[model samples]
Target: MSSPFSNTVYVWQALFLREALDRFFGSRAAWAWLLVEPAMHIGFIGGVWGMMRRNSMGGINIQLWIIVGMLAFFLFRRTAVQTLHALDCNKAFFAFRQVRPFDVALVRASVEAFSMFFISLFILGAAAMMGLDVLPDDSLKVLLALSGLWLFGLGYGLVTSVCMRMVPDSGHIFQILMMPLYLISGTIMPLRYIPLPYRDWLLWNPLAHGLELVRLGFFSNYHTLTVSFSYLYYWALGSIALGLALYRGLETRLVTQ
Candidate 1:
């Protein structure tokens, strides 16, 4: 007889492999597309910056800064977005009694994280080879900050998934909401460009904190707003807790709807 804990572990392993196969190998050159997408984004931005004749931003190598911050944002965005549609993505899996909606959500988030890890490594490796200073001054802090962003993304996905399940129209709104985050989260723009007093307000977006912390970790000389991991994690944990509550309360509806 398998204990529930072991059974859950087995389920996760099965789900992970299934998700991995589909994500990394489901389509022709699927893995290649994954690697190419981000590299292309980075290349385009690097080209733009090169044309502008700018060499640095926020006191760090512009190339490294963009590469690190963009990768971090992608990590969080992928995790959250994938998790948001997890239930629908794995609608077929719900046929099994053991496969709860939240179970699929968790598994989907894990899948994004696993894939992004390699994508980051590959991008950073290529950047370093190209003479970009991609080495982190504080690797541990970089890891922690990036982890926070991912956790928050998972939490965001959970809460939003339930919301979308309850009111399908809101899913469209959530999709739209992600667009502004690219700007406000400081992925491509320097918050310093926003002007002093007004710029501070953007920090209200928890992702801003996570992004700054990542840049700070990567370059000791990197100058940016002071950010707290606590702010980001608070949202992460709180959203996850609330999302779980919603799922527990609406388990029947989630599976049905």
Candidate 2:
């Protein structure tokens, strides 16, 4: 007889493959579109910023800065969005008693992280060919920062997904929040450009801290507001903990609703 642990392993493996296929091959040229969408956004933003004739930021290529920063930010956003919708999309799969809502959430979030890594790599490689420095000065720092951001984003999605599932209309408010978040998180605009006092207030935003840390990791000379992985992780862990509790308490509803 198969043990419970073995059954879970089998379920997770199957879920991963199913999610990965749907993500990369669900649409015609789906994989190509994934690569192209972000590339276009980075290029257009970099070009517009380039017109300002600002070549370097904190001693690194401004375009490269934009590329990496945007990539980091996108990783978080994509993971959250995918995880938020995972339950609804995988409702049919819940017919299998072994499959659970949390299972789908974990699988979908993992797929998004997997996709972002390749997308970032492809875009960065293209930037290198274009002669922008695409190498990180502190690769470990970069990795840690990116990982922290992804974790927090996943946690955010998990918590909000519960909110969304409970009240379908709540998803609209969460969707609206992303726009203001993008503007304030320093993805397209540098935080330093924002005046003092207000900028200090922005630092209270975990995304802002995550973004600044990512930039510091990429450029040795980069300087921004002081950041704390602890601060970011606190939010990450807290949200994930809350989300898991909600899922545990309301698993049947998540699958049914």
Candidate 3:
């Protein structure tokens, strides 16, 4: 027989998983919308860039390159967005003693991660259908890079969600700040194309490092010498530590509010 604590944990996990699945697939349109949004964005961006540059950018196919970068970046962005609002969205659930705010955030992150994975596979399939090369040079490296990005996003979301709870207005500001990061993080362009000083500055963004590592895996000829997994790992670890500290210290206040 399971102990009370173990049973409670199991119940909470089941509840969280059910809630996440419902939110993601609650309606027929929900899943479609999730897939369509990324597809449309990738399409527009890839189309314009493809028209502008008939040749490969940095010897990487523009369409495939942009799609991979966008998908990888979206994994982080979507996870963060979902997680930041998880607490407020699931506030009522806190009435159940076993359902903590952290559980809600974890569920949201898991759902986003699950959604992003399929979305990426779909995008790669579509790209292949369009005559774009979709295979990775190093599949293991690609998986590792994506896993790192997901961890980073989850950590970032945990911190930002707590901040949003403390200061509601900060959510809008955070979204605005993320807008510039998309451009600078090499989602639309390769890091190699950027000149020295600017590239050095851009590398400071851990997401940029994640993106470049992902590109390195995708393009056989692409050489990414500057990206350091250690850099991304540290950012993820630090953010998660800080977020957990804040959450643990303020649990009662956060839940009550």
| TM-score ranking, high to low | 1, 2, 3
Q: Which stretches of candidate 3 lie over 4 Å from their true place?
A: none
TM-scores of all predicted structures: 0.97, 0.96, 0.93
Which is the better candidate, 2 or 3, if ranked by TM-score? 2
Model 2 off-target regions past 4 Å? none
List candidate 1 segments past 4 Å from native: none
Q: For candidate 1, lDDT tens digit of each residue in 49-145?
A: 9899888998888888889889999998889889888877887888898888888999999999999999998998988898887878899999999
**Clash-forming residue pairs, model 2:** none
What's the count of clashing pairs in each model shown? 0, 0, 0
After TM-score superposition, the amount by which residue 233's alpha carbon in candidate 1 deviates from its true location, in angstroms, is 1.0
Q: lDDT winner among the candidates? A: 1
Model 2 poorest ten-residue lDDT run? 56-65
lDDT score of model 3? 0.84
Question: How well is each residue in 1-257 modelled by candidate 2, as lDDT tens digits?
Answer: 99999999899999999989998899999899888877887889889988998887766778878888889888888898888888879889999999988898988888888999989888889888988787888999899899888888889899999999999998889878888988899888888889988998988889988888888888888866678989988888888999899999999898887
Q: What order do you get sorting by lDDT, best first?
A: 1, 2, 3
